[model samples]
Target: MSSSSLQLPVIQNWSCHNCGGCCREHLIEITEEEKRRIDKQGWTAADGIATERPIIQKIGKGRYRLSHQNDGACVFLDDSGLCRIHAKFGEPAKPLACRVYPYAYHPTGEKSLAVSLRFSCPSVVQNLGSAVTDQRIELQKLGNQIVAGKKRDHSAPLIHRNSVHGPQQVNWPDFHRFLKAFDVAFADTSVDFVVRLMRVLSWLELVEQSQFQTIKGDKLNEFLELVTNASVKAQPDNDLPLHRPGRLAKVMFRLLTAQHARHDTEADVRSGLSMRLNLLSAALKYTTGFGTVPVLHGSQSAATAFEDSANTSPEQHRARFAELEGEFNCRTAGIDELFTRYFRVKIQGIHFCGPANFNTTLVEGFHGLALMYPIVLWLARLRAVRNNRSTVSLVDVQTALATADHNFAYSPALGLKSALQRVSLLAKMKQLTSLIGWYSR
Candidate 1:
């Protein structure tokens, strides 16, 4: 790929701190060639590494994955959080996936690739080590390997919007403009993050409703401007509707929690179901007005009568806000920085939507992908609340990411209906701003 063709955001410096989080957290899927390479390494118990069950295990009928130790650490991971392979041979012998810690690549166009990072790493969240831009040469080499001899057909249809340009024809710069606007929308401080998110969703809904082919320079700009304006204005009042949790929301929450429940060891697995159940109960209770409501629902009509009569001062509410914000600072920072970068990077590369939104066209796919950011953010926040942590953990972020990515990658069942369902909910809840607040907190 020519340097000019590489349109990804310049990397700031980043080097893995060897937290061994990924090693333990991920079920490493390896290609057949990788398996052979590891076999040729001549690893043994005498290498000072445990090799009781071998390092590799068969996952499905034909697929193979690196196995974890009985303790749930990567079989190649040592007590010092070092990789046995790197220790035994060298870093070059590590799997491509292992070598590409934090960095992820997706085909941007037929001839281009976009880079994304996993912020679940503490180092990544803190922006530690060298700038990402400094790693350009290495990232390019990896990109070459991934895209080499691979023919990417960019003629796929876009996801939610009715754009006629098809995936390959959509100009990347235009996509970047949309993304920049999105970032700005989230950065707006006048409204709550939830309200900001709702505005973006509302705009997306409009885009999806309109025919993309008919949308040109001024029309597009006008629409975006209108959406931003609406988002800023559509703040929820004190009497905002707080309805019961829908069945779909409950099911999605359960599904998401179940995905998070998987672990490499028995102990992790044992607690997984219980944790998921508890989270589900919490979600239903909070969203459905269950906990705040009386068993005799009708008798509680006058229960909140004091809500209008109470004389709590604005100073008191501000103090409470300050307290919650302080409590959630660390959690909010980690999530916000990670996600903000993640969204901008993907948007710049036009990877979030378009072809990456399954094998689809650019416009609709972009809508679907756009919706995912808020959904994942929402789910991660829920996870944080469930774990009693102020911030979303790298593990939870990774799980949410893997879950959403896996669905888009493999599930043919996710169609326009699913895409629009998410868009509607996000727009209604103004979830983008909520995500920002979560990160800010």
Candidate 2:
């Protein structure tokens, strides 16, 4: 494996559908070289980019990035959801980051770079575009430019944090073994994806309890196989027990979901007392645990649902939730396949953990990844309620997923120590499983 040869998720496929969501949603930071090149190209109002505010603004004393228009679109982004640079000077003239909107590249091994796609893109959420594997040449070329002068050495990922055997760290070979086992278990189509997640949690529990200093090479593979079989026997197929989260746990989950579903793309604003007060007010509602779910960007359906439910009567919200108790868990080929490809892409691209996350250990990271299921389902249920439907649709899931994923790994609030601690605490209290079961309905 080498950085020059991109490692992509075989199970996932993506292509830009020119929706322009990325341009609208992200602040594009450019490099010194990129800034210089753009300066040389000489963009102006004639190019249709904003000139009132400098097209490029200094982010720091020396760092700069493209500025956004008053309406919040990137200056380089045209009205048609196209890049002005691409339309004018060609794709190569655009910044590297612009060229790689949904794709994230991470150094996986000494000489390898693993590829992952962001679910924030609507097309990506819908599994639109070409197969990821088929884009090897273009991705490799992109990879080359990304790592042109980068070094080959990379740090090994953490397997478990503060386990009974102490923190577990392994070389690339052992790390890859764990990833392979995870990929296989997660991709199993025989059972629901939620059940597969529960089983992985069971398997990781075993791994954490063992003395993994000697668990290497073929022994690790054997250990994974044994644990997988044991977990299968214990959980069985479609045999999950219904467990409701405690009231306190529900409050905690509501708060966590509020944080996860938050979309912070506001124009830069100075700190003020009013902003603090508004945050405090929102916090109060999040802690209440029985009100309308907090509104979020990219979550129009959910917000509309909550708004409609909230105004009608308190019973409306409760009745909607009651409706979910029976129908939420049902699965179909289309809905099931989206989650299948989603988990596989995360596992295959190594995007759910390591440096890509908030430096979480593999076990902790998996816990966060598993939570996405319930979070998406909760939001999807809200969408169903909005549409006056009892069952969740594929579009409901996609919209819900895109909304939650908009913040998942990218939100600063989620990367905080307190947020990470909450995830760990939920697992210990058995609330994670309860939430999973309840949401699975």
Candidate 3:
């Protein structure tokens, strides 16, 4: 099927500014075909390519990835922050994955595709450059390549699956109905951003418990309205009832946050056992939630990208977890608009659930996504405190979102059974909203 029917996000704008962070931070796995093409390119010492190792390395049995240079960048990355492959050959000659950075395409219907941006890129997080809708032609071509051989018609991802319901499936039209409801709920600007999320969470519990087989078309819309209105009635205004996350919740969250804050670049991998040991120590500190917050190495990409390049003395390296707990005055129109855009993009692209997330049900997936608010705010608070500022700014939030989202759906550790359980447990203990409200203080 042709990828002519592409749905681009209107609220977001992105264009790569050649920060080269993605090239350094990500290990690009190549297909056998791509590896063979690179081998045939006849690279040598004269081309500035490393001669010590083959351009491709075997990661596992028959699994291969591009090699990194001594400075921990893709072998194709040049000194001027450009891809050697693109300069030598063409953009088409590069690996498909290389061409698809910052944009994620997923099947929204049999013939249509939805594009979601990865905020790991500073350009994307800042919403800088041209509007995404204007790039439909290029994105459509990429979408065609992505879904070239894949099935055109795919079954909709399950709505809510569990021991009680076994597995629940809905038609694509009805599935989109639920998505529309989500979009509308999030689009409501009458309430505070966090309150809007809390309202959705309040009703999503009903979605988890209720059967959806009979909820179709107008019936589904009515059901959604009923539940959403009920949620608003429960909590009318932004007078959020804040409660501290329980000790267990805090420990689990800190560990998870620590994972998000890490940088698993090829450089870190090449450091070998010593790097692993340092990570182990940091993990221990996060688990205890005492003393100083460990200086997670990869967490500073945002600071590096957004902050003045000449600021040598960064204090985030010395912040304590307790220091992040103090109020940073997180609520503001600008901040809410940033989150609104972030959440809408995810929802509209259906990027929070199904194959895009960790194969979680709708409720579970949204809960996991909601957890990002606190995590991002907490990291933003850390960034604020590091700079000797008592309040968080949009830049801090942007940096935190970029850093935390690097692992959001891409990290293998986050998809594990234990990680999934942490989200569920937080919701069960009624700590999810608590964390959101408390951290957004």
Candidate 4:
């Protein structure tokens, strides 16, 4: 099937600036076909390709990937921050994985696909360049290629199947009805973003209390409207409650935020006893949440002072981190717009729940998504503190966002059952709402 018929996000702008960051960050695996094709390229020193090692390394039995230079960049990356393969051969000559980065394709249905942008790409995060709609031709071709010959017999994704909560089993059609209502609420600019989220959370609680088996088709729409109205009455306009997260929840959140911020680039070979000890020490620091900020590796970060805070006096850590709290306001209309676009795109693309998120219920997936607000805010604060500023610039927020989204739904650490449960627990304890209100201030 042609990918033109596939679902695409209506609100997004992205164009690669050729930062060469991906080439240095990701370990690209190639299929056997890609291997043979690359071999046929017959790269040599004469072609400006490195020959110190085999261009392709065997990662596992019959699994192969492009090798890296001593400087930890893809072997095809030239000194000018360009691909030697593309320069020598062409874009088609590159491996499939290499060609399909920053943009991900997911099978939303038997015959439908959804395109999701990775904020890990600075360009995507900044919403730079052209509208994604303008690139439909290229994206369509790419999506079809990605799912070539794959079966199109997918069952619709579930809403709350077998969950340890109320109204667990919901039909996909009814669940999608809930999605549309939530998306509308999120897109509503009448309330603050946090307030809109809280309102949705309000109605969602009622939806869970009611039996959804009796709700389908137009009944589900009416059910949603009823709950939404009741929630509006309950929450009222612009009235959101706030409280501090519990110590335990805060500790767990800090650890998760650390995992979100940290990255393992191609250059990162942190293994062996040293790596274990480093992680242990980092975990200890994250658990306490009292020291200076942890270093988010591989971001080429400009926030160095915070990273080396331990070397400073205890008084300095206390003073600097405290300064990060009150007085260093980071929230701005532009920042809110960035986050709104991000959430809307994820929702519109159907990339926030179900199979797109480890089979998490809509509420659970949104709990994780809501956590991004405070996480980004915290990282932005850290960035400002490190630069000896009391304000967060757009650059600070953009970098922090890229850092946080790197792990949002992609990190194995965040995907474990325990991690998923932690997010759910935060929502259960109302810490999710509290964190949003606290950090937004």
Compute each candidate's TM-score over C-alphas. 0.65, 0.91, 0.95, 0.89
Question: How would the candidate models be sorted by lDDT, starting from the highest?
Answer: 3, 2, 4, 1
What lDDT tens digits, residue by residue, belong to model 2 across residues 34-134?
A: 98999999877777777778888898977887887765678887877788888888989999988986888877787788898888777777777889899
Best-performing candidate as measured by lDDT: 3
Candidate with better lDDT, 3 vs 4 = 3
For candidate 1, the clash count comes to: 29
Better of 1 and 3 by TM-score: 3
lDDT of 1 by residue, 254-280 (tens): 343223222223224436787567555
Best TM-score among the predictions, by candidate number:
3
lDDT of 3 by residue, 307-420 (tens): 622124653346778899888999988889889989988888878888898788777888889999999999888778778789999988888889888999889899999999
lDDT of 1 at 72: 66
Per-residue alpha-carbon lDDT of model 4 for 1-441, expressed as tens digits?
555356667778988787787787778999988999989888888877778888999989889988888767888988878998888788978888878788877665556677888777788877888999888889888887888866653655555433445536555466568768977888887767777777877776676556666678899898888888887788777756668667887877787787887766555652456655766787887787666554546353212212333223344333243455563554567776788788887776766776777767776787788888888887777766666667777777777887777677877788899889888888778777777777776
User: Scored by CA lDDT, what does every candidate get?
Assistant: 0.52, 0.77, 0.84, 0.73
Error of 1 at 197 (Å): 2.7
Which one wins by lDDT: 1 or 4?
Answer: 4
What candidate 3 gets wrong by more than 4 Å, as runs, is 1-4, 151-153, 299-303, 308-317
How far is each candidate from the true structure, as Cα RMSD in Å? 10.7, 3.7, 2.0, 3.7
Higher-scoring candidate on lDDT, 1 or 2? 2
